[model samples]
Target chain A: MAGRATPWLIGLTLVLMAAGLVGGLWLAPPDYQMGDGFRIIYIHVPSALLSMVVFAVMAVASAVGLIWRIRMAHAVTAAAAPIGAAFTFIALVTGALWGKPMWGTYWVWDARLTSELILLFLYFGYLALVHAFPDRRTGDQAGAILAIVGAVDLPIIHFSVQWWTTLHQGATLKLSGTPMPVSMLWPLLVMMLAFLCYFAWLLMVRLRAEILRREYRARWVEKI
Target chain B: MDSWHEFWTMGGYARFVWPAYGVAFVVLLGSGWAAHRGLRRALARVASRVRGGRR
Candidate 1:
């Protein structure tokens, strides 16, 4: 399905990411409250958002694979697991870096933070389970179940700031209204789009390889 | 030059700011490269099968 569009997607992602870097690191002005430290929001928000989005993708694909017994669906779940883990790790690390100066600690038991951490662990567990079984089908089924269950944490993580008095800040650019000035907001939005595209590029490339791997023994594998 | 210096300094939050961005850079680039490598490995196997026949 991804075919030749993969290269073009990668190129576009690179361009968008570079533009995001410039917009974030240079064009966007410093925060009045957090000062330059708040620039971390550019990376933090995008990676954080992407982590959840990746998990949602993995969970949905896992469910489809389990329900319909689709080989390609399982392949998608397998390919997305590690990438989702990577994104989650990025989010946690960047969040910690941003936290130290603002919150007086690198980590805390805040609802948002803890839930996001659990999300990372869920990704890890899913990846481990997928490869654990000697029989690949059993492994995929087990991982899919776990992914579906863990997806309950996504909304918990998202709403934690509102539900609890966490060290993490509430949404800065809500659909209702943004507290941010145009300069800061635009870069953050660009960075988020860039990261989303980055995930898309990664997923397409990975799924291609995954599909090939899963179908390697099939007769159709030779023709492609 | 002064404003540029201020920008880099992150208004004195440079320590946190730079590391945050730096780690992000390493992770994103590394993951993308890894995915590309995996794709190559998968494709290379396909090409190899044509020459040597399936294992």
Candidate 2:
């Protein structure tokens, strides 16, 4: 099933990403205040959003694996960790780049920035814990527990801008609609969708790999 | 042609803007490549293991 779906997912991701980039870079008007520097938000916001979303996914998958002893659920947690970490890294680097022009610094020890950085570390911790155990089952269980525990950071990361005075700005895209013009907003929306598709594609690929590794001795694996 | 140059300049913040996009592109592409490579390696390992077990 995954084998058939992977190509379609990759194709969709590429198309959407290209469209999003063209729209953001050319069609969208520059910000009144930040000018073209604001274009970084096209990628930064999507990466930031995905970093949290992927962690939430990992936490939920970990919980499911713990409760039901589902190996596939654990595999999902494993598959998502490195991808989530990558997104978090992108979010930080792009954010720093955005900050230097707008905020006049590459980084600040502010609430929003700090919490997001913590998220990157949490991903690292989960990956390390999972691999540290000699036994695969023990490793999965330990990693799942760590993932569940680390989920507390998600809400903190989300509300940090509101809860504290920070150089980092509040959410531009909100459920209540944004003050941004339609021209700029549409491309961001497209980019967000593209990132989601990219994540799904990567997840499917990694999950397949994780499953194969775990089940290499099984009869089904031999058939594949 | 000058218009294209202006687009690339990104309104004088080209240094900041382009690098941000560049980093995102590299990280996303790298991760995708890594995931694909991992899948291929796993497949190869499984194939060898299965053959060995049968023999």
Candidate 3:
């Protein structure tokens, strides 16, 4: 169903990403304090946000699959797992790079960092459970349960900075307002949107391939 | 030329800044390529199965 639209989505994602990079790396002014090092925020923040957003998406898809007994929903959970993991990985590495210059250490055993690491592990665990079972249905069920359980970490990751005295700074962008100047904020916002588009594009492509694999024996698939 | 050098230097934090972006670029691109390859492989397998069944 989404085959024709996939190419268009990829094109749109690329354009937005290019605009975001230009806005972030070139147009945005250097921070008064951190100077150009703050530019990493353009990549780091969007990646960190997507890390959690993708997990929430996977958890919701897994829940729906469990409730509705929909194979396609399970396929979506499968498709989203590795992408979420990749974002989580990027967030960690970029955060570390930012940390070393700002925090003077590569890592700290802080609440936010630890919780984000756990989120990566959660993704790995889900992927493992999905493949562990002999029957695909059983694998889906097992993976779904693990995904639902792991969602408890999302709030923990979000609130960690607030609840603990971590080296990591408090939220840069909040519901009320961000302290960032308009020049910097706009690029960050654009980059966030670009990353989101990239995520959606990947999810759609992976979901199509997953659905095809799962339904290869069905009449509709044969028609394709 | 001076301004270009400053841009690349990233105010002396270039070591940390460039690698962060580089890794993000590589990981995202690698995953996208892998996904596309997976789709092609699935299509090939399905086509073959259908053809074999006909025979």
Task: Estimate every model's Cα lDDT from 0 to 1.
Answer: 0.86, 0.94, 0.91
Please give each candidate's TM-score.
0.95, 0.98, 0.97
TM-score of chain B of 3: 0.90
Docking class of 3: medium
Best by lDDT: 2
Note the residue pairs that clash in candidate 1. Answer: none
Instruction: Please give the ranking of all candidate structures by TM-score, highest first, separated by commas.
Output: 2, 3, 1
User: How well is each residue in A1-224 modelled by candidate 2, as lDDT tens digits?
Assistant: 88898889889999999999999998898788999899999999999999999999999999999999999999999999999999999999999999998998999999999999999999999999999999999999999999999999999999999998989999988899789999999999999999999999999999999999999888888777
lDDT of 3 by residue, A182-220 (tens): 989988888898898889889988998898999888878
Which ranges in model 3 have alpha carbons more than 4 Å from their true place? Answer: none
Model 1 regions more than 4 Å off: none
Candidate 2: residue B51 lDDT (0-100): 77
lDDT of 3 at A81: 96
Question: What are the per-model DockQ values?
Answer: 0.70, 0.77, 0.70
What TM-score does candidate 2 reach? 0.98
All candidates: TM-score of chain A: 0.96, 0.99, 0.97
**Interface RMSD, one decimal, each candidate:** 1.7, 1.7, 1.7
